[model samples]
Target: MSAALMALTGHAEDRTAAAREWRAAAKPVVGYVGADVPVELLTAAGVLPLRLAGSPRADDGAGERYLGRGLDPAVRSILSRLLAGDYGQLDGLVVSRDCEASLRLFYAVRELRRIEPATALPPVQLVDVLHLPHHTTTRYVLAKVRQLRATLEGWVGHAIADADLTRAVVAHDRLRDLLTEVARLRRRQPARLTGTQALSVVAATTALPVERATELLQRLLAEAGSLPEAEGHRVFLTGSSHDSPDVYAALEAAGLLIVGEDHDWGDLLFHRRVGGSTELALAERYQHNGPSAARASIRRRAAHTAEAASACGARALLCYARRHDDGPPWDFPAQRAATGLPAVSLERQPYGALDIDARAVAARLRVTEEVAR
Candidate 1:
């Protein structure tokens, strides 16, 4: 088998292992963090926390009927899969006001619990993102979080403790540092891993103990050799669910090197973590930094891409979303016109459907490289 396929299978295995690890170690694992939900909050609550978006893609079509807008085939399939007993094992789901699509997805699931009391699916509901000042799109998030927490606490029959939150903060902070080290390895040699492999970092981030993840990263880096020379084109992407190494992979595949980006799963989620703080403090810090609460995750995503274009030595900006994914549309036009850099946009479908032709994307990148050279 080709290295890519083998790696894909292995990556899936790693995810399974990580999820089982988290579930076995911590019950009622929650996967609701977007951009900056605090690990301490979940950890302190004795909940196994995972990022819901990281699950291997499935067909969720049943989710479409309940959503009001932007329901694409991919989204539908994923939701359908969910309703068909794919994620029935989840004890509860935490939804963030991530985007129109995500918000709708959350609503769809939330409604199910209300309408179908006997459904095997776990508790589901919306997460209000406290929108940033001047960005009223998600101002209800804070109240929503508190309410959600209370609901979660009541259901679990135990409230999340301040002390537990503090411990979670320490653990999360360590995880952040550990991920940073892994990012460093990518910066040095983009080929040592792929975007999916990098997802192992994210998977482990939500599941594995920070220390173990760190050791694995360190070991991975030890084997990382120099990046195989590229044709020297570079691009920064802005979109949904980007793992850092995945950013590098898209760039390289498009014949560019990834120097920077603003995707939450890429940078904002992994930006920087405060150290040695209490759980409440740590939760507060995450709430403060995460873009999930931003007025527009799209606009926020765009601005980050704009900034990266200048600083990351990028030759072009790529603003693409997975097919039917609307996360990039909100701020893309403005970003493309204003960044003073040429940009390319695409609609990608998980690891499966890449609506944008690879060669075409690569060709543009090559053109940029030729000019740069």
Candidate 2:
């Protein structure tokens, strides 16, 4: 791997490294918890947008004490870290209503700050963008986006001009374009990069500065042709979002080459571009981009997953939903039927547990392929 790829992967693995560096330089950093938050607005507000990711290694006992065990493990992990002051450098935090877990996380954080005054929690904001495709939904989301802009402006103590937003939009659009090219490379006949590596590359973009992320991506793409091609049964992943590449690494190690995944941390992160520079355009783009497991209908989710898997030339599908994350499992049956491919569903998986019988999975995929042939 090139030095740039290594650096980006490092950032992905160490989620808070870039944010800490930025804070040490006396720059303000605003942390957001989910993919639904409009990062471009934060960039336009003259603050670094730090994407807050959860760790599988977090203390589940402590998390359960505060937020209870009913929440997704990823959300629990984030809450645990916040309680431990792991994200003290954040100037503010934005929680999106992208899923039920995240929305509940926002409420939990707010109540914790109230009851536990000594805890080092940042001021939090919520951006609720309803996902329904209707005029009222569009209007509501546009208002929410504008409201987020106002909140960010209040934090920076200055107006975020249209020019600032325009520049930010352009930069993000370029970054998305570069990521799309990287996706194409990953889908090549013999993938130039493994799914684990691709997840790291995409996750790093959320942690680093946009310009730096784009530069690193360009460097990686330039050096991609020289990387060793991955070999295994081509597979598509659809389930809970992956904050770390541990599962991908494990699956790839077991002879399953993950070419694509429809999770927020992977290809879905840049699925849509801000078609225009205006707030309304941004709202429309996100509200209608790809079908999200949490918000879109089962048919929509199934069609999107099928299209993405076919486009990537995947031979099989793997649906791995974490315990307590209900959305993905609800869509699994439809997704499997829509794809019309050999599929496996691993439900109620524990966080950080790589106990998947991946060898058996690989064998099954091979047998299915031979039978089809």
Candidate 3:
């Protein structure tokens, strides 16, 4: 492969090949459903949870035919490509009832393409997050996990014992340690990691097997650690799906590097697991992420956002709500007041068209950075 191709593939050039080995090492060959699903659970289950997403190169013709009029054309287009075979390689899929788009995506996956000739598309597991009340939702969630565990056991032809759970944690934690280093370097040094490159890190859980990802990550970490420190304005972002390295791309292009973030998909959610094989460790793993699929009272949503905002050290917070997303709406008011920091709210129609005006964000930060200097 060309050097350019190697870079795009990150640590492992042959993730598909690595995945086959991982599946052999693991049982059940599971795929997680939620963006917030703990990598530990799948690792422990001997499953590989690959995050599903849209990329510019993907074509969505067949996906459009699947969803019909259920979702908007843009969302359907993305789904068309994904279901049409974008992530057809995954053994099983985990679906979160997180938002309109995500929920719809889950539904479409379960309803359509329930079978494929090449491989079994992941069995869809619904995370019952109907947000009516805490107790009610929690019980539903716990039961769902049990069901998923049972399903996974059947797939593997054995059970996930305490030892298995603990072992998965060890392997996954090793991977997270590498990620944490990368995240810290991004903060302490600033911009060593980009938003796009960051997503590739998150994408690793599903895209490659544990052993190979760790090897690639080890190489990347050594290289990243040797890079020079980043000096400039540091901004914290709290939003959905900012893990794709666009932050690295955009901020680096403007001569600023993202030092920290409150985004749910990366550091915030990534830190939720460690050192436990107990059911509680597993349970807490799924519940504490920044956002959820359940419809909560407006108050709860704001609380979650305030958390991400305050915790992420955002000097300037960009609300990357995908045009009418409830997750961001719930967090807006509290997040606006959570920090003394200045904030920017950008409505995104999709990934390629982040309605955020680059000039506007840069102009605002430029003045602030100068003032700080």
Candidate 4:
């Protein structure tokens, strides 16, 4: 692999490494727990915005105690890390009320900080942007974005100017364009990259500094055409957003190439850029950009899934939802009908190894392919 690809993959595998390095360098680092948080606002405030990922392998007994066993596994893992002081170095933390589990996480962290003053939790703020596509909802989301900017300003001890936001927006737009190119490469015939590699690159973008991430993406794209082609059944993944590439890696190892996905961690993350340099523009863009399982209607989600699958030349669809992450699974039936393709629904899945018969899935997909032919 090229050095750029290697660096991005490493950063994705170790999500906190880059943030720790930045913190050590005396730079302010703020962590966000959901996709809805405006990263541009954080960037404009001159702090590193790191997206937190749960470590599925972590022994999070504390998380079980605080969050209980019924919550989403990824959320529990994140709570465990917070309780363990894994993010003690962060200057601030933003938790979005994008989904129920993440909202619960915000409440738990806030209460924990209030009761246990000795806990090393960073100052936390909640960005609650409602996704209803009405003018009232848009106004509400815009107000929330402004509040987030104020909170970030307080953290950095300075007002975030429009110039700063404009510069940040421009930088992020460039990053988004570069990522779009990478996505195009993934959809190429005889795929230029593996699903795992594509996912790693996406995850790394949120973990690393924007400039560094953009540079790495540029380097990878320059060499992507020459990368060895990946061979497998072209598949589209939907349902729960993936924090790690483990699932993609396993599925690809089982003879499937996930060419596209409609999840926050994948294509939906960069589906739209900040339309303008202002907070209202950012709020409007996020609120209206793409269908999210947490906020969008089932029909819209299904339509997006079908459109994305067709665009990527996927022969089949895989809908995998994690335990307690209920929103995505509700769309599966609609998605199955809309796509009109062979589909598999792996619902209530765990965070780790997936614990499914991969070979059986591969065999079934092969049979479906033959039947389609």
Give one digit per residue, the lDDT tens place, for model 3 in 147-172: 76776676666788878777877787
User: Model 2, residue 340: what's the lDDT?
Assistant: 86
Q: RMSD (Cα, Å) of candidate 3?
A: 4.6
- lDDT against true structure, model 2: 0.88
For each candidate in turn, the TM-score is 0.76, 0.97, 0.77, 0.97
After the best TM-score superposition of candidate 3, give how far the Cα of residue 289 lies from its true spot, in angstroms.
Answer: 3.2
Q: Give the residue spans of candidate 4 off by over 4 A.
A: none
What's the ranking of the predictions by TM-score, best on top?
Answer: 4, 2, 3, 1
Q: Candidate 2 lDDT, tens digit per residue, 159-234?
A: 9999999999999999999999999877999888889999999999998899989999999989987888889789
- The worst-scoring run of ten residues by lDDT in candidate 1 lies at 1-10
Question: Which runs of model 2 end up more than 4 angstroms from their true locations?
Answer: 368-373
- Which regions of candidate 3 fall more than 4 Å away from where they truly are? 1-17, 20-29, 68-78, 113-122, 129-138, 189-191, 215-225, 246-248, 291-314, 367-373
What lDDT does candidate 1 reach at residue 340?
Answer: 65
Error of 4 at 286 (Å): 1.5
lDDT, residue 329, model 1? 64
Q: Is candidate 3 or candidate 4 better by lDDT?
A: 4
Judged by lDDT relative to the true structure, which candidate is superior, 1 or 2?
A: 2
